[model samples]
Target: MFSKKWMNKSTNDYWDKISNLKKTIENADAIIIGAGAGLSTSAGLEYSGKRFFVHFSDFADKYGLQDMYSAGFYPFETLEEY
Candidate 1:
């Protein structure tokens, strides 16, 4: 198993807290999921080979991103630059 340590040990701990929030939402009057980068990752929307490269093969090869994580920080000055 991937260590919970990697995902849960961070000071921000957005992943664990978000999981807790999911459970809380079940009982709350309203549940709102704000989709953002971290949430997308939690939902398994990783930017690595599968999710990003599959759709953006050309981009991946040109920029040398093995996965989506690296792609986000492609030293990008602009979207067009990458």
Candidate 2:
């Protein structure tokens, strides 16, 4: 979690954060980047629009859900149903 000190920081503060990050990365032995939904979506694994309609049309009709992300927030009565 970020602290309130990070909020409303000046340009110099941003540069300081970036410099610290650069040093940390430079001194690191290894870095593991965790790519999530945004990465996959950017790589064409979209969860909405045509793809969502194609794969999840039935769920959309049954549950009134729009897309995969919205479906995750659906109030399914059971985990199996979800």
Candidate 3:
């Protein structure tokens, strides 16, 4: 379990790490990046709460999808449904 104090410390540590990483990326001649959940969220591809409801309300209503992650694995009857 995470306490508030621990969470704050972790957050500060992460920001410090990212700041250093930004400097490295800026100085590097070339860089490669791996993308996943964090990158997707950063790029505004989040699929829950307000964003999900706003963009995919029709899909959610028809398929009972709670989140976009689950929708990726859901089996639909037609290409249109998918």
Candidate 4:
């Protein structure tokens, strides 16, 4: 479980981390950034509980999808099903 403070922290913390890491990114000469759920979460796109359920209820009602992680695996019978 995460500490309550983790969620309550100012959004600036995310930018601060990115700013502090710029030197490493520059040193590595990174050309492209690969982003996924973790990166999104760090930048504040976390989904869980009511938020997750609310956003993905279509997948849940049709195919019993409980989360986006599982929704990615769902095999649909039609494009509309997705």
**lDDT agreement with native, every candidate:** 0.73, 0.87, 0.86, 0.73
Write one digit per residue (lDDT tens) for candidate 3, span 1-82: 6556643355577897899989999999998887779887888776789988888999899899989899999999889868
Residue pairs with clashing backbones, model 3? none
Highest lDDT scorer = 2
Which ten contiguous residues of candidate 1 have the minimum total lDDT? Answer: 4-13
User: Model 3 residue 22 lDDT?
Assistant: 95
> Scored by Cα lDDT, where does model 4 land?
0.73
lDDT of 4 by residue, 5-51 (tens): 64666758689787878877778855787776888888867555687
| Stretches > 4 Å off in candidate 1 | 1-36, 76-79
Candidate 2 vs. true structure, TM-score: 0.55
Cα distance off (Å), candidate 1, residue 1: 20
The clash numbers for all candidates, in the given order, read 3, 0, 0, 0
Which model is ahead, 2 or 4, in terms of TM-score?
2
Rank order (by lDDT, best first): 2, 3, 4, 1
